[model samples]
Target chain A: MQEIPKPTIRRLAVYYRCLERLEQKNVEKVSSKELSKMLKIKDSQVRKDLSYFGTFGRRGVGYNVKELKEKIKEILGLNKQWSVIILGAGNIGKAIARYKQIEKDNFKVVAVFDVDKRKIGTQITPELTVRSLDELDEFVKKNKPEIAVLAVPADAANPLAERLEKLGIKGIICFAPVTLTCSIPVEYVDITVFFKTLVHFISRGIQ
Target chain B: MQEIPKPTIRRLAVYYRCLERLEQKNVEKVSSKELSKMLKIKDSQVRKDLSYFGTFGRRGVGYNVKELKEKIKEILGLNKQWSVIILGAGNIGKAIARYKQIEKDNFKVVAVFDVDKRKIGTQITPELTVRSLDELDEFVKKNKPEIAVLAVPADAANPLAERLEKLGIKGIICFAPVTLTCSIPVEYVDITVFFKTLVHFISRGIQ
Candidate 1:
């Protein structure tokens, strides 16, 4: 398979959500033009992105909304349940644990970890408990969660990320403001970057 | 100025951050190759992104780390302070309001708004309070925030976004899972999309 562009992956997810919404609205079919109009991107861009997985939509008739949605869901690995452990019990980590969308998308938070002894025994959700960072080795040995969320402070992130890699974690979702030097695939949930992007547009006087 | 690719904007922010880290290490100069190696991107890509601003660095000596960092900060509009209002008092909203990095980046949360009566009149930080959504008009008139954060649920996002645009909000940072259809510039903080991106890599066996 050819290497896909990173931006295309992001857009594919957006297209999946667009298709999901169209499906919700009982819209049976959607053209690339229609999807493009809704998303404010070029129609050709839409066709090109979907073409990545294989040409699905008919040239004239367009794509079947539910089929396209399901295909993208499977492509994104959302069809399978993913076990996740968060590395912090701070405000952001707790919010993520409580975020209803993660479970709906099949990424379940199986555990929350923190270095703070005061927060170690607390409950994030009824089913999930905050555990000590020291206990991570024991938990990973048994449960083997594939993803680790780095919601710790910047100073703590790199060391914990190193520990997670040693524990056989495959991927990471980082919320730290600082960048991690980990070798594994790390996705950032940097809200400040979004703010900077927004302000970049604002300063440029673009709507 | 030429139209910049959205990905370029995002990468510029990343480069800005990388430069900040280099500057902290007291590294006085950096080559595009060195930066690309650190960020795991092509050297030409880094040069192309920096070229969007202007010709900044010498041919052989590379870029002065401090100067390059400062220039990117100015280009990203991070040098100026931005007043912001968040439109939800939920866990995500509270997390964002309490996010120390936003204030560090000069984006100040002037107020938080919510429809929940129980959350209204509450303090998020001692300097900021959660106000009723009904009071948005009066507050906007009195203290015009340049940016509004849509941290509300999917169902409530669009209407509140429309209202924010009407009140002259320049840009938005959205946390809702749904795609917002507002006219103004909206940057998404979609954590699920990041998760999906990570899983796509994991499924593809990318490191």
Candidate 2:
């Protein structure tokens, strides 16, 4: 398998999403210029990023919408469904559970776990049922979810992340603001920092 | 004013957040090595990034935690509260309105607007009241929210963003997956793409 840079992978996902819109609008093809204009990126950057995989676009005619969309999906490893388990039923966790993007992106929220007994047994949606953290080890061992989302408070983040790491979980999406150091080779994306940056950019304006 | 790279700005935010944690733990000073270990970044990179602003760290003694934290906050322009508005009052919007990070980061969600009558006039929280899209123009004109968060669907993203642009909103945080093009200069951060990348990195493992 070919290795793709992380930044390139994110651009591929963006391109895939853009193609989805074009496909819905019945647009047949998209040039790098068009894609760049819509995405606010340089056209050369878009073409160069796409060129890493193969020549999916015609020089003069641009890229075939349907073909480009599929190619991006295949490249980003989004062609197959991945099961996701969200830890913590707090505001952030529940927001993610109800987020429409997860379903659109083909990630299935299999279950939600929280330490609060009051939240246990409640339903996020009909598809996702809340369970106690006590069941986490058993559920993870039995179900083997591909992705684990950490939505617990800052105090709980590191310990829970360690627990997820021990469970042999591959990926962790952490919402807590606390910094987590993991030796067990888990990938973590911090949403609090992400949102903070978003707010910072908006307030300070991008340079 | 200096032009700071977007990635650097993001790192500054992360450092600010980390420093906040360190302060709460009563850590008076931190070396770049310690900060890097805590944030999972290279110590050299951390020092280089910090050097862009000024000589923040001493050669041997490292950095003063509280001083470094305050400096980052000042550099990122987070010392003042930023007024924000949510374009959609759906599940995600409501969750953001109730999220504690907004308050922690000193961002105030002044209002939430949606076209759905069922959701309009509903209270997300006591501070944030739901308003109709009909009032979008007037509310923006009157309040002049510095940051506008696009939580609307893909199809509605561009149009709503355009409206926000015309109304003189400075920055936008896009939650929709679609590509957005705006006449007014806007900083677009796709939360969906961020989460998708997190999931991808976790599932595939980051090298």
Candidate 3:
């Protein structure tokens, strides 16, 4: 199999989102040009990115929006449901647990864990409660959530992540500012980067 | 001046962050190999990325931690203060407005605006208030804030962004699921991407 560039994979996710909006608007078919225009990506670039996964569009009529979206979802492994756990019950953690994981189908929060005794056993949402850190390994073993969202402070991030990975967690979406040194995957996020990157892109606006 | 690649700019920001950590640990220098190992980028890739911004280190000695970090900061223009506004008073909006933008040093939220009458008069922080949407134009004109975090829902995202751009707002970090179609710079953030993309990355783990 040909390895797609990381940027191309990220762009595929963006294209998936665009296709979804198209589906919502009841727009069925779209050419590569339309998709490129909507995303401000080059038309040739779009074709090159999609070519890594088998071809999708008809020559003249373009591509079926629903079909292309589903194909990307399957390629991305989003078609499978993924149970998720939040490793901290901080503000960001609480917010993420509460937000519906609709785009991620099966990827929904199954539990939230924090060290704060006060927050432990408290309800994050009616659907999930803040569990004690002591119960994390045991609960994760039982339920087998494949992913964890690490929202602890930077100081606590590495330790919690090491433990999460030791307990068989496959991936982490980290809100804590620290970069993890784990063998398993870690995606670091900071709310500020969204702004900084925006400014950078603006300073060097699109070609 | 040479135009840097977008990915290189983003990586420079990451290097700035990594160097900040190294500075805290009293680590004075880092080889491209060590930095690449930490970030999982190729050693040559690190050298090439840094070269785009000009020579930063001795070939044998690697980079001075503090000096390299400061250089990246200047290159990315993070050395200055930026007044930011939040365009919504929702949960995510409220949280972003309240969180100190101290790390992005000087990238602080100066005001928050919402169309909800009840929320419009409320105080977000002792330092900030939730002004009504009607007051946005006047306030922006008077204060001249160039950056905004768009936390409004998708329905309100487009129009508010359009209005913001017309008023000369330069950059936006949008949380709404909808994509913005504006002439000025807009950065879209859907928190859900953290998990979905993590899953995607883990599914297609490094080559």
Candidate 4:
């Protein structure tokens, strides 16, 4: 298996979105040039990025829109359904559960967990029922969710992350701005930190 | 002014966080190799990234922790304060308003806006007041805010974006997942679409 760079993975997502737009227009095929223009990126860079995987585009003609979309999806590991569990069931958690895009594919929100009794019995969405934090191990053991979104407060983040690690969760999308220490592999994406940094940048006016 | 790549900007954020950690530990200086090891990135890459602006590291010694951090912050435009406004006072909007990090620097969340009359007079935080959507133009003009965070639902995204553009807001960080068509210069970072793409790839097992 070839290793995909993280930046490249993000670009693959952008490319997938572009293909979706192309397909919606009933466009049969697209060239790297066309995609670059649509995405406001350089054509050669697009071609080079795609080439890192395989020759999805033909030299003379172009790429088949549907085929290219499917290939990029496959490359990004979006080919199958991935069951997801949301921990915390707080505002952020519920917001993610209600997020429309996460509902597509097999990326179903199987369950939500919170220690708060007021939230435990509540339902975030029709598909996601709130459960106790105690049930997390059992839930992961039974449901085998591939992703766990950590939406708990900053104080609870590290402990919950450790628990998720113990439960053998694959990937984690953390909302809290806490450094998670885990033995098991997990992708940590701190949205709060990401935005805060952006705000800092804009405040400074670097360029 | 040299163009700073987007990836480098993101990494600068990561480096900032790392520097905060170093400062907490009372670390005086850090070499590129040590920083790279701490970040799990290549040493040469770290050196190259810093060298983009100018040589910040000494040949043999290392970078001055405090000085290097300040330089990176200035380069990323974190020197000044930026007043930010959220367009919708919903769940996501309130979340952004309540986010702790945004309050640290000059990135103050001065006001929130909603269409609901009951919500209009509400306070999101001690610092932020929920105003009516009709007040956007006047409020923006009076405050001269540099950045706007669009936390309105997907349906209201584009229209609100246009209004923000008309109001001459500099940058936008949209939480909604709608495609934006803007005449003015705006920077958008869509959280929903970004996470969905992550789920897409994880499910596909592309890596």
Query: TM-score of chain B, candidate 4?
Result: 0.89
lDDT of 4 by residue, A1-207 (tens): 466666677777777776876788899989998788766668988998888878868986899999988887776667677778898876678877876766653467788899999888986777677999998898899889878888887679878888787787876787766556654444555654455556544554542
Q: Please give the ranking of all candidate structures by TM-score, highest first, separated by commas.
A: 1, 2, 3, 4
lDDT of 3 at B183: 80
| Per-residue C-alpha lDDT of model 1 across residues B127-165, encoded as one tens digit per residue | 878899999999998898999989988888888888888
| DockQ values, each candidate | 0.73, 0.50, 0.51, 0.30
The CAPRI quality class of candidate 4 comes to acceptable
Candidate 1's residue-wise lDDT over A1-207, tens digit each? 577777888888888877877888899999999999888889889999888888779978999999988988887778889999999999999999999888888898999999899999998889988999889999998999999999988778888899889999989999987677788988988777888888888898775
DockQ score for candidate 3: 0.51
- Model 3 docking tier (incorrect/acceptable/medium/high): medium
Worst ten in a row by lDDT for model 3 chain A:
A98-107
Which 10 consecutive positions of candidate 1 chain B have the poorest summed lDDT? B176-185
Interface RMSD of each: 1.5, 3.1, 2.6, 3.9
Every model's Cα RMSD, please? 1.8, 2.1, 2.3, 3.8
Residue-wise C-alpha lDDT for candidate 2, range B1-207, written one tens digit per residue:
567777887788889888998999899989999989988889998998788778868988999999999988877777888888998988777877888777778888888999999998787887767889999899989988887888888789998988888898877777777666775434445656655666556545564
Q: Is 1 or 3 the stronger prediction by lDDT?
A: 1
* Model 2, residue B83: C-alpha shift (Å): 1.0
Residue B23 deviation, candidate 4, in Å?
A: 2.9
Give the DockQ of candidate 4.
0.30
| Off by more than 4 A, model 3 | A101-104, A201-207, B101-104, B204-207
Residue B24 error, candidate 3, Å: 2.3
